[model samples]
Target: MSEIVYGNLLYPQDDTPDETVLGCIRGARDVGVTTFDTADIYGMFRSENLLGRALAGEPREELVLCTKVGMPTAGGPNGRGLSRKHILESVDGSLRRLRVDHIDVYTAHRYDPETPIEEVMWTFAELVRSGKVLYMGMSEWPVESITEASRLAQELHVPLVCHMPRYSMLWRVPESEVFKTCDDLGIGQITYFTLEQGVLTGKYLPGVDWPAGSRGTDLKGGRGPLMRHWLDADDALTRIQRLAPLAEDSGLSLAQLAVAWVLQHPSVAGAVIGASRPEQLHHNAEASGRPLEADLMSRIDQILGGDLIVHSA
Candidate 1:
């Protein structure tokens, strides 16, 4: 799988046309990005539809298509969770939208407290056996839940291959327990929020107004609130800005530096990145295979400081 997976979350934005979004997706593929990640709940299912249209003619065997279920897509009680009915129903909808016979990876978008772990594992196993999904995994699941599911997966013969976690320089909670547990279970991590919602990209400067059209200013769609935790912290912004000089010294953009930092982890199989433009995708793809020296890593740690980073859950 490609280390840089194009994430179709907020892409194909309400304001952006389908042609522009398709162009960006194709541009990512042009830059050697073979893995594309999306979910049924993302963009209320439009993302999967658009991604399906974008990659319709490509050789299916050469690409890795991933999507998630278990998020509420409708108002009814049966509309969500990892129950057999939901998973069984959701997979067919995902297949129809993605225009694919089998998803390379099908993940539980989040842990469902209402469902039994055994049922979840067994349902996923059935999908694998039925050829609707190739592998199974989870995103943002609790550590105990992951361990329990991993155990159940073993008994059910499900191929639980990866864990999707929110990991970045600013958010280091996964390092405390998730990484070790996944590593022990022989599962690789495909991390999201590697750029801290564009904060680590050096676009939001300390003591300065957010750049026009940035996530910080997007009050609609709840993006602004999602980024408020970082945007409201000037000290964190200041520290993030300090990394710019280091990024330049290494001949890398701040976004590339941020993405590379997550990829540095041994357990990280890939980093999912979202981009509105093709050039952004091209720039981030360069972070793959680039190693930051130990000295640089230590310097980054010192600059961000212990208090600003979240090292535990």
Candidate 2:
């Protein structure tokens, strides 16, 4: 299994030069990363465009390109949602921006409350049959929704290979019910935020002024507020500090330990980590193929506490 996946969520901004993003993408490829994940909403479409540019010369067959839809790409009420019209339109935009004839995995960014499940599934079924998408998936969907969608997918004879969710030592929402539902439905999990927006990197020390060049400092695009829960939770921060030695003893960095911990679950197929610089890929790739022993796993669970919030949202 591919343990770590490169995510375009935090790809270099639209105004920023493309050289950094291109270097990061190629760096991951050079390090043997076969799967790359992105979304239409990422960077408001800039991420896909940059990734398309970055992968221009790579062997198409050797790389697995995964992308998503169902988020607003433009203004107005028609901008987003999983309606057949929106999906049909969005897939083409994604394809053109990605410069790919067919996407290996095309996922629904989220369940659309406004659209019927049947409509969404049927659209995806059409995409698969038309050869534009190899498999279908969802992100951050509840178990009930997944079950309903899976039923429709089975009826339509389309393969729903996996679901993307935020899973890490910091968040275990999937373990509560999503994992079991997917397990029963034969769906895999491709988790994101394995490093908790770099919180698990041990760079954001408690009570320290938001460090220079950190996500917390860049409050633009509304990214900083998302880290408030971790930054404000004094207890979680203390526990994380204590965890540093344990990770060192295991010959793993805290980031690597957090990622490998997520992959320990049978339902998880991959963990997505966003890289802004090329060197970050090397640290993340090392997390793959590393085994964590039962005792260490138990110790980690105890440290995080049994009553950890299942979902961040």
Candidate 3:
């Protein structure tokens, strides 16, 4: 498995042509990236369609294709949840769109309070038994929910292999409980937001306006609102700037340093990275397998002090 998994969340933008998207996916594969992750809710199912078309003729065994379910895909009570019906229907849709016989890792995008843990686990087991999904994963779930599902997975003999979480130097909510719980459960993590939506790249200055096409200025897609926390925190932005010198000392760009920091964790199996341009994939892929010294890690923490960081629940 590749250390860096290419995420298709924001790829194939509104104006980007199908050919361009296909080239980007092939470019990522050529750079040694083997895992590709997308979701049914991403781009309202357009992402999966595009990804399916992009990877049509690739060697299926060499790639790890993952997609998610359990998000509101339609308007009605049965539209979205971990219910057996929804999961069953969603898997077929994903399979059709991805042009795959079976998914490498099928993840639950969010916990479904409306569905019982037993129902969720049994549904996943059915999928695994039928060869529709090889492994199960959960994203952004509470510790209690993950534990309950894990317990049920064990009872059902299902393979609950990964937990997808939003983990980064600036956002450390997983450190408080999720990390230890997943570690104890023997579940690897595939982390997203490792770059904190590009804030950790030191591109957005403390005082200057955001770059023209940056996510900080993308209001229509809801990315700007997600970035407001860091954008509004001048002290955090200033602290991020301080890390630039450290990144230079390590002979890496700020973005590379950010990606490397997340991959340093033992439980992290891979970090999901999104690339709009093909060159961006090559740049970010350099962070894989590069180890940072312990002293450098400590210095990074010192530079971005605890006050500006969220290190716990």
Candidate 4:
């Protein structure tokens, strides 16, 4: 349960070599990264498959293998969603791909409105009881769904331990509602996009074309669309430019500063980041276990401005 968890999004995508992905996973372990997060839909289940190979010969007890279901892995009505049929079927595939007997944490990749929450809860309960999945979590689920699921999970005695949400200085939607809801339910937040798809890494500058081989370059279906709003905003870039010097003064890289900022929230148990290279993993891994000063946090808020933060009910 470290402050930073590794993600496997960039792996298997962009045609990254198997050796490199394996090295990244091993490198993460060398840097003391305990938990790795991925989903079935990511790289069309190839992410988990590669992770399985990378984790070969590693101590399973020491590592937490977290993978998500409910995302479409193939073309079909039953191919996705949190339906009992899908959950039951998908867990086995994830287990097979991860090369594990059981998943440490199995999360719903997204909210499935088609299926009733009761069915989802019961299915998760069965998985936990059967030892196919140790814990249940959700990603990008609405506040209302989380509230209802919390109630049902308590009733079912299912361990809903954490929530995975997209949270960053640029993406404050979680702050508006998801964070508070999860907090009230005693669910820790292991957030993704802590670096805003590498936007906060100080690598993407305003008015300049993306550097070669960057995620912004559609190297593997870049996060361009998801981050378009922030990437295109001149004001956001200016804020990032101003924050860079402050991070340098604090003796932290911009990436480290961004990670630290997200970790400052008490409800955040960890932040998830993707790595294409071992050195990238090593650099971001440094962000964990470091506390930022309150003054610096306030300064960051000032730089981002009040309007940037979305506070929801």
Q: lDDT: which candidate is best?
A: 1
* Clash list (residue pairs), candidate 4: 176-312
Greater lDDT among 2 and 3 belongs to 3
In the range 1-313, model 4's lDDT, one tens digit per residue, is: 6667889885335588778888888888888888999888877888899889888778889889999999777678898899999999999998999999999999998999999999999999999999999999999898899999999999999999999988887677788678777888899999998998898998888888878888777645765576676678777777788899889988889999999889988889989988888999899888787788889888988888877654431
- Model 3, position 188: C-alpha lDDT score: 92
Report the alpha-carbon TM-score of model 1 versus the true structure.
Answer: 0.97
- The C-alpha local distance difference test score for the whole of candidate 3 amounts to 0.89
lDDT of each candidate versus the true structure: 0.90, 0.85, 0.89, 0.86
lDDT of 1 by residue, 1-313 (tens): 9999999875323556788788889998999999999999887788899999999999998899999999888878799998899989999999999999999999999999999888889889999999989999799999899999989998888999999999999999999899999999998999998887788888988788888888777655536554788888889899898999999999999999999999998999999998878999999999999999999999999999999998876
Clashes of 4: 1
Off by over 4 Å in 1: 11-13, 222-224
Displacement of the residue 192 alpha carbon in candidate 1, Å: 0.3
Give per-model CA RMSD. Answer: 1.3, 1.7, 1.6, 1.7
Tens digit of per-residue lDDT, candidate 2, span 1-313:
3567888775335444578888888898888888899999888888899889999888898888999998888778678989999999999998999998999999999999999899999999999999999999899898899999999999999999999988888788778788989999999999988888888888777777767867766656425555777878777777888788889999999988998888888899999887778898888789888889999998887888866544535
Q: What are the runs in model 3 whose C-alpha is more than 4 Å off?
A: 11-16
What 10-residue stretch in candidate 3 is worst by lDDT?
10-19
Per residue, candidate 3 scores C-alpha lDDT tens digits across 269-295 of: 999988767888889889999899999
TM-score of 3: 0.96
Q: Which residue pairs collide, candidate 2?
A: none
Q: Count the backbone clashes (under 3 Å) in each candidate.
A: 0, 0, 0, 1
Candidate 2 Cα outliers beyond 4 Å, as residue runs: 11-16, 307-313
